[model samples]
Target: MSEAMRKPETNGAPPVISVRGIDMVFLKKAPGVLDGLARRAGLPRPEPVGVHALDGVDLDVMKGEVVGLVGESGCGKSTLGRVIAGILDPTAGTFRFHGREMSEMSPQERYRAKVAVQMIFQDPFASLNPRKRVIDIIGEAPVVHGIVPKAEISDYVDEIMLKCGIDPAFKQRFPHQFSGGQRQRIGIARALAVKPQFLVCDESVAALDVSIQAQVINLFMDLRRDFDLTYLFISHDLGVVEHIADRVVIMYLGRVVETAPTAELYANPRHPYTQALLANMPRISTEKQAFGQIKGEIPSPLNPPSGCHFHPRCPFAFDRCVAERPRLITKAPGIAAACHLLEEAAR
Candidate 1:
């Protein structure tokens, strides 16, 4: 087993971060009465309804655990990460940090939460300021927040750069001067400078090369162990998630479809969506799949199919799947599935 898979388990500890039935609905702007005219003129047309970016997401991250959030693009994995990091408030449902209700926190408690939860974005170069030098980019936060004295900022930044595997000599250089991997390291260093307890990594390695991806993932594991950090690692790459995640959460069209411990989910996926995803992967093992690929593209969230959101694409979907939504229910130990056909599949 990989070292990442060997990390200590939380074992049902109280959650450091918790979310229940959180809904993040975004109002996609409409183009007004010009819809027909715009279409005729080959211009952009209006949307009829709001985008359901996240619909009734429930998740919990125990302290020191790395929970991987996996799905295709536009599946709300990144939005869910943002919600957990406090970058975006949910439209509905409860969010608690260290057992304290997010909405009910005092001013100081809110500030602490804000600093404790940090986000490392997908595009490292785009996230970094072009004009700022590496030193200011990483050291400014701690200095301004009184975590590090102004006089010690340079040394502090140097220490951080070393920790993140960046050369201190590049402290004076801008983000553009560094390679993609180095820029990502700088981004990681910047997040660490704030002394965050939790990290929401939104496709943090998606832009890197295959070799670089492994290196960055290894670095994340090292840092997680060193800092005792908890993470909501969001990415579309199931291969990466399989390698690093202790627990995996799968989402489809703004809602969670399945969740399970890494080994069990990969060994036997309960949801058809999860099965399709696994089937689509390039399997180099001895096993051969009897089924073909999942058909069609994902339905637009603005008009997601009623009942089970995944029913439209599911092969085994029956009448019940088209009439009523399936709630997330436990199917086995450390496994939960949100599909009407789960029990039927088991039998």
Candidate 2:
């Protein structure tokens, strides 16, 4: 990717997706009949508790840019993607697409915005309707969105399947008949059928074999070139993220800890958490070294550790780290991290 395209500010174009202070909280339990009756009867109800899925997260994806969102499992990577894809609304935040705030959009504008951002899930088979044929699964959306005329849906679906590397002959087959990799391709095709400008690929290839993962990753690059698509690729695979992402965002316990250009981050990680993640990533080396691991378990989001979420595991944790949360400060032209060490070094 060209520098101009990677950084939208150079061209003065708004990011394809701009998120600020995004927070997603899910209720621990659904309300039952008694809870509802209590509310209706004006009786005292127990306090509602929530899982902090995302907390004060911020991000930006320039047009046609692929940003890798990497974190350990249950670290809010998928939750952040779902919010960006419009599948789940954040409890608090400002989400903008092409300079328009989603919250401020009129009904028609919101509908169009929703259609423009699509998500491809990790479980291809589960995401697809088991009984629906490939054609219906991929064709129905474009028809409903008026992207294609109902009469031309078949031809459109065929064209899409072929573009996604699936055979047009299998359009009538149900998802169950296809292999895992093929089912993932069908999911890709269905997302593309809607003519979306952005896609949130939440562990899109994690279920596939290593060989199949390569094919899917290449397909994503091809589609980006062919369709002018921007992506928020969420995954825990550091190797895969390094290969495909132009920039990387690191998350831990529902907070963004570091973000920088991919090469810069890999070559010179700033935050201790980011450094630990990269240190543990498996890489082939002639001089053997034991695979390192970050100390301590990740704190629960429900009751996250005070101040820096990674302080308990961070090797460089200090009094300041335990008492005060560090702000994401700019260390270089394109690098930012939330760590007290950087602040101390500057001081």
lDDT score, residue 314, model 1?
89
> Which residue pairs show backbone clashes in model 2?
none
| Model 2, runs deviating above 4 Å | 1-10, 30-47
Candidate 2 TM-score over all chains jointly: 0.93
Instruction: Give the number of the best model, judged by lDDT.
Output: 2
Task: At residue 122, give the lDDT of candidate 2.
Answer: 97
RMSD of each: 5.5, 2.5
Residue lDDT tens for model 2, 191-223? 999999999999999999999999999999889
Q: What is the lDDT of residue 104 in candidate 2?
A: 87
lDDT of 1 by residue, 262-322 (tens): 9999999989999999989775678885556899898888789999988878899899999
Displacement of the residue 3 alpha carbon in candidate 2, Å: 8.1
Worst 10 residues of 1 by lDDT: 1-10
Cα distance off (Å), candidate 1, residue 306 = 0.9
| TM-score, structure 1 vs. true | 0.90
